[model samples]
Target: MIRHLTNGISIVFISWIVGMIINAFLIKTKRYQEKLTNLNFIKSKKINKLIGIGLIKWTVKNTFFKFFNPKLRMNNKVEPNDLNILRNEMTLAEINHLIAFIAVAIFALSMVFKGKYLPAFIMMMLNTLMNLYPSLLQQENKRRIDKLKKVFTRNHVSVTATESLNIS
Candidate 1:
């Protein structure tokens, strides 16, 4: 059972790495350039307006939570009211991880059928790492935001007073 699981895991890891490399290459080459073109020539301002409204609602919700919800507040961190936004940002990372997992599973199955163990075990670890990477990124971003907020807060008082006093 352990050997089969390991085999599945390794194949998934390799396939996932390949997928990410391909995605990076495509991004650099502007292979999906059409997406940019479509966004730029948006004919319906209605969609834009709807998006604006949605943003406003999200802002209001976030503000309410950040100011009023103690449990949601992190020390010096902006509390995101819309968890969906975080999830959306994570979607790409999740997809990459999923791809890796699938590849590993396939590889493990192959090993089981072929009576191999070492490669399968290796892939399991790799796939697990790949899938967990996105969660790491989310934590990193949170830390960065906290640091930025501290910097801005320190400067804000001086900046506001300067503006109010009409300092040239």
Candidate 2:
């Protein structure tokens, strides 16, 4: 049992590394975004509600962000261009996670046939926590960004028009 468990763990870790590398390559090549965007299957509202993201565990997410979401150079106030870029980055990441989820599913399913049930179970749990939860967070964030975009666009145009009138 110990040996089998060790073997299963090794497989799961190897799968994770390979999946990350493949997803990174796809992202570097700019293929993931277009591919995922075309599929258009991620429905944020239902997914979030289904996962109970709005519940009390959101505090855990806040804690998770402090450690994992390293915003290296982001300031308190971001320009519209920067916000758009961030939104795109989140979208791209969410897609890569979707890919990761699929890879995990494949690995788990494949392992079950080989009698590595423990590893398969581990992979599925990881898939739920890492891939699914993060995707939901990204979707929630993107929606928030969209709201900001609308407000920014509205305010920016009005401010520009006011400046033009003053100059005239």
Candidate 3:
């Protein structure tokens, strides 16, 4: 059982790496970014809470994984450009996890067909926790960033208009 658990974890990590590599290629295309940006599996915060994304988000923020990608965190004051960068990073992360989840899911299904129920269960559970949850979390964060970006732009436009009226 221990060996199986270790192997399952190892497979998940390997799949994650593979997914990153694959995403690097996919991201070169504009269509990929557009699709990911528009992808909304959950529409509202209430739905996000019902699905437990808040829990997964809290876990990532509180765990060692918080240190995994420092660039994703907005520690200081965020500007419009910074929000754009973070949104792009979030999209990259979301797609990477999505690719990893699909790959691991295929392997788990194969294991089930082979009657390796224990290993399959282990892989599926880990895949859900590691890949699926992270992807969902990124999507959630992206939504927040989008809303923030809109506010910044709107405020900027209004301020510019006010300045023009004053000049007039």
Candidate 4:
């Protein structure tokens, strides 16, 4: 019975790791890139270029989240439903990654307890990579936002000057 339980857990863990890796590949390749870019082509002036930039930035962040969600175990500050949608859409992948992560963690802890250094070192490296992927997306968003703010300010100034001249 104990052997069966360990085997089952191992299988679950392997499946999760495989699924997360697949999703990560898909997102990083930017398959949905053009779909969201089309949103910027709207005719309304109110929509503006800034909105498009914002949308693209958001899409990148969301794609990053969807890809490696299991390893990261992240949450959205603004919407709970978004997290649910992400998990649901990538169900098998998310499940496999999470289970694999838990299994690896347990294995690493066991090794550490026994003073087995090499396995623990490898597991820690993998864990660090999983954790860092999400932060890269977040930092990219901040950089994009700073660039957008400058553009927005420039556009605001030009529009204001044009309008003031017309009024005179």
Candidate 5:
């Protein structure tokens, strides 16, 4: 028990330091965002289907966890800029959560080697089903939103330009 306590505490301390470093690195760089957004994950289908898959989205949306929902209530097609900001925020959060998931999973795997098999298994399952899957889902949604924004903005701009030209 004492050994487990010491090891777990040390792991938590190290995880915190590593997480802080990853957070700093991620925040300082915006150049990689396009790359992140353009990833071809689950590309065979539309991003929405790739993400939610029926009851998962229904449950997640209905659950309305404040952490997941953020503040995306605008008429997205009308408020493209706000929608973009929200999407970007979700993307960043997904990246952060993914990093945390990796860190925790690694620690949990280490625990298994130390004979804490049940706890490690439980932690791994929790992170996989909760954190990792949610991050993937958020990334897919962001990708879809990015596509929608581009199409919406292009049509909005061209139509406006065309109307002004016709008036002139």
Candidate 6:
């Protein structure tokens, strides 16, 4: 059981590395970004809450994972350009975790076919926790960023118009 658990953990990590490599290659493509932008699996914030995404978000922020990727962190004051950069980063992260989840899931399914149910179960559980939830969390964050961007754009445009009128 220990061996199975260890192997499962190792597979999750390996899958994560593979995902990063794959995402790095794909990130430069416009089609990939467009597809990711249109991808909305969980549309409702309530559904996100129901799935315990808040817990995952809290864990990532509070744990060593926060230190692992500092780029994802946002400051108190964020401009539209900053939000655009953050949205791109979130897309990259979301795709990475999604790839990792699919890779680990495939391995787990293979283990099931081979009659190694315990290891498969362990692998799938870890994959869901490490990869799936994180991807979902990123999606949620991207949605928030999109909303914020709209607000920022609107406010900026209005402010600019007001400034122009005052100058005139």
Clash totals for all candidate models: 11, 0, 0, 2, 0, 0
**Of candidates 5 and 4, the better by lDDT:** 5
Q: By summed lDDT, which 10 consecutive residues of candidate 2 come out lowest? A: 159-168
Better of 1 and 5 by lDDT: 5
Stretches of candidate 3 above 4 Å error? 157-168
Instruction: Give the Å shift of residue 20 in candidate 1.
Output: 4.8
Question: TM-score for model 1?
Answer: 0.34
User: What ranges in model 4 sit over 4 Å off?
Assistant: 1-87, 128-168
The alpha-carbon deviation from the true structure for residue 158 of candidate 3, after best TM-score superposition, in angstroms, is 13
* Cα lDDT, model 1, residue 18: 63
For candidate 6, lDDT tens digit of each residue in 1-168? 889888988998899899999988887888896786556799998998998988898889778878766788776556678778877787888898899999899988998999989999998998999899988988888777777668777777322322221100
**TM match of model 4 to true structure:** 0.29
TM-score: the better of candidates 1 and 2: 2
Give the whole-model CA lDDT for all candidates, comma-separated.
0.43, 0.60, 0.80, 0.41, 0.58, 0.80
Tens digits of lDDT, candidate 5, 2-34? 555455545544554565478668666665465
- The alpha-carbon RMSD values of the candidates against the true structure, listed in the order shown, are 14.9, 8.0, 7.0, 17.4, 8.7, 6.9
Model 5: colliding residue pairs: none
List, residue by residue over 52-157, the lDDT tens digit for candidate 1: 4334324434555234223322332223332233333333343444445565567666876787666665655555554443323333333333444454567653
Among all windows of 10 consecutive residues in model 3, the one with the lowest summed lDDT is 159-168
Error of 2 at 151 (Å): 1.8
Q: Name the runs in model 1 displaced over 4 angstroms.
A: 1-14, 17-85, 132-168
Candidate 2 CA-lDDT value: 0.60
> Of 4 and 6, which scores higher on TM-score?
6
